[model samples]
Target: MIVETDGYIDLIQYLTENLPVLSEQQGSKAGTSSYTLRECFEEQLSVQIMSVCQQNDLDQTMRIDIVREADAILYDFEEVLASVLDNHPTLEQEEFVTEFIGLIKNLFDARVKA
Candidate 1:
């Protein structure tokens, strides 16, 4: 919900800094993000969001709360999310997106229950 409200970039930036250190290897880290690494998700989401806005005739730039706009365009996500992942051809991207969605959903679910 916050992602929808604030847009995903802030969360992505926070996660880039806070994403768990799952494992480390030989001066390389896996499953974490560098600030620039965040650009990939930001760019892809922006592109997909723009496409959704265009198709729905809703200007995303006019959105005061991105998640709210996205909340209204829920069906579009199921379609766009796949494309976003498709645009990125790396296991890390897939894993990051999937896991991030899971975490966000779980968080939202918990909030609703409360």
Candidate 2:
């Protein structure tokens, strides 16, 4: 049910822009103790993707693939994405949370099925 449609484009841009800040807000406990999978995903996938977004080398598709791969490895990836989207106070689309989760699941399935 997913394709490279307008929703996909919006989801990707939103993720590319906001996920980094969300991760920062989530804030990894630096020198405290052990880390949760969410923490790892935030640091590895979210933060790293922000850096990748800053660089001019990778295309949007490449960025998407990176997110998909990261999702494949992280448990509850959909929840993570939803939380990121849900927590945004300035988010324009108020009702896009569930649909965005589906879009992300599509990408996640693509990576996993491959």
For each of the candidates, give the backbone clash count.
Answer: 1, 0
> Which segments of candidate 1 are over 4 A away from where they belong?
1-10, 16-87
- Give the per-residue lDDT of model 1 (tens digit) for 43-96: 445555544444454334444444564454343334344333223224454456
User: Relative to the unseen true structure, what is the C-alpha lDDT of residue 47 in candidate 2, on a scale of 0 to 100?
Assistant: 47
Report every candidate's CA lDDT.
0.43, 0.46
Q: Which lDDT tens digits does candidate 2 get at residues 9-60? A: 5666775565555444323332233543244344545544455445436667
| Model 2 stretches with alpha carbons more than 4 Å out | 1-37, 76-114
Pairs that collide in candidate 1 are 4-67
lDDT of 2 at 6: 58
Error of 1 at 38 (Å): 13
